[model samples]
Target: MKRVLTEAELKDLLQAQPEWKLQEGKLIREWTFSNFLGSMAFVNRVATIAEEAGHHPDIEIHYNHVVLALISHDAGGITRRDAAMAAKISTELASHTSPKHE
Candidate 1:
């Protein structure tokens, strides 16, 4: 089973992925788009990413805003796998229209 990230590792994750926040034992990030279509487009990208990595994140869609939380439930908290997935998602989105972070 995957282990929870160490304090140092968590710090590194936060540093590397500044947009992501360590909240309630999960890595969370939120984005706001110009419209609902824009939000859905971003969500589709995330879906493909999560499927490829086999790391599904809890997704919340509220019109043009979206929130994603990554956690390794089996590990009982965030792990290296979650961090890696976060990086992947960020990289994928970087090539597209810039995400409006909140």
Candidate 2:
């Protein structure tokens, strides 16, 4: 099973993902898209990634805004898996120009 990330390690990992915020033992990010369709597109992409990695995140969509919070429930907090997923999502976002962070 995956282990929870140590405070130091979490701090370091978060440094590399400046857009992600650590909140309540979860790695969180808020994304703003051009519109509802654009937001749904981003959600679909995230779903594909989650399926590929076998790690899913809690997603909240509000019109043009999408919020993602990732945590390893089995590990009881954020883990390396969460960080890795966040990195993958970040890379995916980098490839798109429609989604601007809010």
Candidate 3:
């Protein structure tokens, strides 16, 4: 059965996701892009992942910044699933920021 994550567990998870933070009782991460198109591309990629995982995030995109919040309404709060998604997002952002080799 799915369960809500405890404070200690949340802290441990957050340690690995340095870009994400606990904001107003929610797990959130912010990203900045070079342009609106870049921000939208990131959002679309995140949307696809969320849909595949059957989990959705609260997203806000403005200019070149995108803020993402992850919470499980069905679980009544944060869960392992939320942490996992955050980790995945962190990885994706890292890759996105990396210089491409060609």
Cα-based lDDT for every prediction: 0.89, 0.87, 0.82
lDDT of 2 by residue, 1-102 (tens): 788989899989979998889878789888887889988988998999899999999999999889999999998999889999999999977776354444
Ranking by TM-score: 1, 2, 3
Global local distance difference test of model 1? 0.89
lDDT of 2 at 60: 98
* Better by lDDT, candidate 3 or 1: 1
Model 1 C-alpha lDDT per residue in residues 9-90, reported as the tens digit of each score: 9999999999899888899998888889998999998999899888899999999989999999999999889999999998
The candidate scoring highest on lDDT is 1
Q: Number of clashes in model 1?
A: 0
Tens-place lDDT per residue, model 3, 1-102, is 579999999889878776778877788877778889888988998998899888899999898888889998888888999998988776766767422221
Model 3 Cα shift for residue 92 (angstroms):
3.0
Whose lDDT is higher: candidate 2's or candidate 3's? Answer: 2
User: Order the candidates by lDDT, highest first — what do you get?
Assistant: 1, 2, 3
Once fitted onto the true fold, the runs of candidate 1 whose alpha carbons sit more than 4 angstroms away are: none
Lowest lDDT 10-mer window, candidate 3?
A: 93-102
